[model samples]
Target chain A: MKNFYKVGLMLTVSALLAGCGNLTNSSLSSHSNGTKTSKVTTTGTSKSGQYSTLLQGGEYHTSAITGLNSESDSDNASNPKSFEAGLLEISKKEFSPDKYFFQEGKMISASQAQKWLGRKSKNNPEGLNPEDNGSTDADKRNPIYLQQLLEQDFYTQNDKNYDLSGMTIGLSMNDVDYYTKEKYGAKFETKISDEQRLSEGREMANEIVNRLRRRSNLKNITITVGLYKQNVNDSLVGGTFFNYGVSSPGQKKVTNWKNISQQNQVLPVVNDEKPINSNDSEDFSNFKNHIQSYFSNLSGVTAQTHYQDGKLKGMAINITTQFYGVAQIDSFTQFVQDAAGKYLPQQPTIEIKIQTVQDPEAILVKDYNTKQYSSHVFASY
Target chain B: MKNFYKVGLMLTVSALLAGCGNLTNSSLSSHSNGTKTSKVTTTGTSKSGQYSTLLQGGEYHTSAITGLNSESDSDNASNPKSFEAGLLEISKKEFSPDKYFFQEGKMISASQAQKWLGRKSKNNPEGLNPEDNGSTDADKRNPIYLQQLLEQDFYTQNDKNYDLSGMTIGLSMNDVDYYTKEKYGAKFETKISDEQRLSEGREMANEIVNRLRRRSNLKNITITVGLYKQNVNDSLVGGTFFNYGVSSPGQKKVTNWKNISQQNQVLPVVNDEKPINSNDSEDFSNFKNHIQSYFSNLSGVTAQTHYQDGKLKGMAINITTQFYGVAQIDSFTQFVQDAAGKYLPQQPTIEIKIQTVQDPEAILVKDYNTKQYSSHVFASY
Candidate 1:
């Protein structure tokens, strides 16, 4: 009986890893995916003969994979949020919220992820990073090739359970790798050139995809890969997914890699090259000037602009005020809303975070698709 | 020279603890404080003769005392946020953002807090809770009194540094204490009566205040104490600050306790006692129905209402939608804003969290001090 049970478990594991059914050209269209929305017309129903429910429920099935929070100390505060949001945004192109439910990565184990994130060594073979060369010099010499690996899984509802239909993996590479000279010594950094970073990222992503294809459960699922160059340690904005590629089911590796032209710049670009769009800067300047004029007690007013393909896609403005009362916050929020409508571009999404030195005061936002702005002021009592 | 340095350190600590310059009746106004906003006539400056700056700069000086994240396993998800926000809210009455800068508690160490939270025993003389009876039965025979302790310190600017002027402490008493009969055994709960909970919370607060007064750094600072009753584990909303008291500078114990009639109720309340205000329920129901009529794809539309002294204060509505897309989310958010404006009372602060099965879609809010509503829809790239 015990032998029969062991055999049953093995068969189940094999079926989970090997099963690939109903692969079509349309299902493979997520390949070569970018942020561009190309409308796919359907009969108002998914291939499963049901209307795709965008996140049928709000709670995501927690990751079956462990060790998500293990290497938290090594992560930048911005990397985790930006990496996950960007991946889900990218995945929407192929999996579409209408069709797939979201879940944290389950296929990769902690040991597997740790190995891939480490320097390739003779003793350990699964390392995707290049082998380290012993060097003390950091600025222009030896650099850590990889920083972190994030995985997100997309699922489709089956008869009783959700089937793993697609996966998105994000590889965060370092622009400046920080290392210590000796145990508990001064920290040093090695700057990675753009060319070296992109090339290494692409190479590692391809190798990772090829490797996962060898696993039975990972053999026939659609895989999307994004390569991100993490921002400098002191940078205010997080890094972007600079490049992406996709591997279709039954494929061995990723191909046709596309460069994503996305950049985040602090507004009032000083001591730097001219912004990609002069109009965006001018509008932001006008908006800032208008709010600054209305309120003289403001600590600071600044914005971070997001550009895609050299076009202003969004701007998140931070307005720091010295005021505390509900009356003061409400009045300032009203004026800012009016200023945003008058000065900011209507095509790009705009967000304004109103805050004090102690806590968040209010938040105002405008969606790209609509002219109306939405806002919320926190309650004090 | 080493002895001289030691003497200087002792003098500095003595000065920090015993500095009681300019003690007056006006400075003691923070005593017997509540949510009531009784306007104080200010000469455009604080007692220090400095124009009160509400969090002068946006960044708060982090906590000097450590052990904040310890015992996180014993905390409820909502308790941390509510406790901190509520304490800050209570502190605002006395410390006024205009006068004091916010900081995490500096006087109380982690070990001291842990000691106070444990059951009083001969081995641990500092424990504030009742000594354990060693009974196996949890429901009627055994009970745990306290759950967690949180502290916030407020500071006033000095010549070179911010002087600690006031401090607030939150004692989170459990409503239903969960315990295990044996190691890794089945969990059991002891339902505490309102009389037992409040009486124990008051006693602990008094004991805690007296103990804190003996410390050098904590002795002269004005201390505010709030007693909070944590909600049941399965409840949707967090607990409320049910009572508060204050200790003037140089006082040893909290006195003149005031009952805070604050309660949070889920809207369209079912199988519960009559709501504190019928108008609030009607407004929420109308708002929910109106939005539901406009958006049929919503999974659920519910609200949590906050009341104080039998008067409606705030309502946080969660609109879970099945829709995905910029156009759909924007439209639904617009409709929610319209319905909120038409249905919800103008005096109460209103917040609407628009979400999908996967991620946040948008947010709409109305400040109690203003009629205009603010909304923001999440940008999906």
Candidate 2:
């Protein structure tokens, strides 16, 4: 059944990719060869005493507590290690038959999926790595990766029966032992709402299917930039605050926590695998072409160019969306200067022309095309 | 002839007094009983020769240059011997028989008058009594007094037949010697104009009259009031700047020259003999009475009063004169506490009710009556 589901999911992904236009040339032209990777891991234990048997069909539990066992266990009530150990023992006693599945009703046990996913650990043979135990560096870790991995695993188990649409995503992080710390250390924890986590898993699966259908490099593929929590009082879930095409180390990076809480201007890169090329004319051209294409795609939009001293200076992009119906890109001269100051491409006076967009989807294609691209469109007051 | 003239002068004075109200209780009540006399003596050739004979006629002249020589020899030139010698010498040279009588066929010389007026001298005279010569406090001596004495002699001699009404007075005291010693010494020579000299004479006479009128037993009656020489461009004369009534020795008085220069307030008293009893109800009542009397004496003028906080504050004296037909005392406030917090009485609050007068005497009488007698007349602004 699991093998049947895997085949179905691949076929579905193939269908989706067939409908998408070829973007390989544009992507290839813009990006360099350099690639970087980030690894994230998680660990848990099943209810059964036998590791292989527990993987087949059972409920699982993970110890939430961290770093409490190594110290002397005087009045063990204060130690989280004792509590976690106790909870683990209780969970281990409760045995129920269950299966981990990639797609709906695909019932794949840990023993069956071990080869395709990754090798199981010899010490703790449920295949979950012991090192992938808990959250650390709460602000830097990405929640989307975990959600995507879950979706991918589910799709591998269940193929055609699962629907990834109509799902939402919720991500959060905090330090459980924050008050216990005497110094600046942050003992962080994160919780994703069940509904939101499911939604994110489905969206990520859909993205992967799309990438596979298009025959694009899986390494180069990017999921939708998720909605970031603005601040404590913000009612809306997701909104695009910044674009991520412009890159720098501290410039655009996403984490488990929201940018708003950090009081930081962060732009989460949609395509992190793509390398930035400083010397390539194709890269500059691609940037220019992308900008031009963005302007052309927008309908009912007006482009206006600014000039100073008889020289073309900058452009303003005015957009009329449903919520922020009238929005403007004040001027592009400064941005161009910041982006292209060192390159000195043609040494020509760069001017920008704004193109207003009623349907922003045409200009910001990535936002509409991605499955995880749900946004809370706000109404202008 | 001198006796005959003297007798005639006495008769004329008597006639003038008769025209005025009798020295009955009404008038006598306002004046002091005791006489205040400023006695002077005569000396030089005027005591012995033809010049002496001329002195009987109340005039003197140099018979010959030899008499001039003896007189000049006797003249210390630096320090005048006595008031008598000074007067004799000055009168002989500066005043002649013709000068006194305004004789149709004769002319008087300036040299004769110069001797009596005394040359610019520094030589201290022998047997010069400090009191008589005015040489002890000579440095502090007021030139205004000497000038007044000279004017009195001039009026006594020359204007014996003329009424001294509607006469203008001008007074100037530059302390030429002191000024020269400080700035240019004996090198400075002042060329006195006839008009200037004449004006000085008139002012001297007016000062004498004013001083005589204000005869209080208090030696502190001596006031050094700054007299401003009006520019030729100015249209008005006979205005008081500021006056410091009296001072204890070695004390700083006249500290505020600017306040005096901007003479916006005036305090005129009727009788300096009595102490200013500001706290006494009768004293204020008497003051009001005097003001009313003064106002009544004036003709074609009106008086008004102002009240503040239900208290009789000030009086306004309005006059209708020829030049400025309807002029009102712009401001008049009594019992004002000056900047130094000194509670001075008889601090006259006077504003010239009229700019110029066709019938000044009438206006003057009206103002005097209103100011002194009427309690109802408040300050004019």
Write candidate 1's Cα lDDT for A41-83 as tens digits. 1111112211232221222123333224321124455555566
- For model 2 chain A, where is the 10-residue window of minimal lDDT? A372-381
TM-score of each: 0.50, 0.16
DockQ of the two-chain complex in candidate 2:
0.00
lDDT by residue (A117-167, candidate 2, tens digit) is: 221345435321122323444443332222101111211123223221111
lDDT of 1 by residue, B280-363 (tens): 888788878856654577788887777878778787777788755443454455545555666778887777788766556677
Count clashing residue pairs per candidate: 9, 70
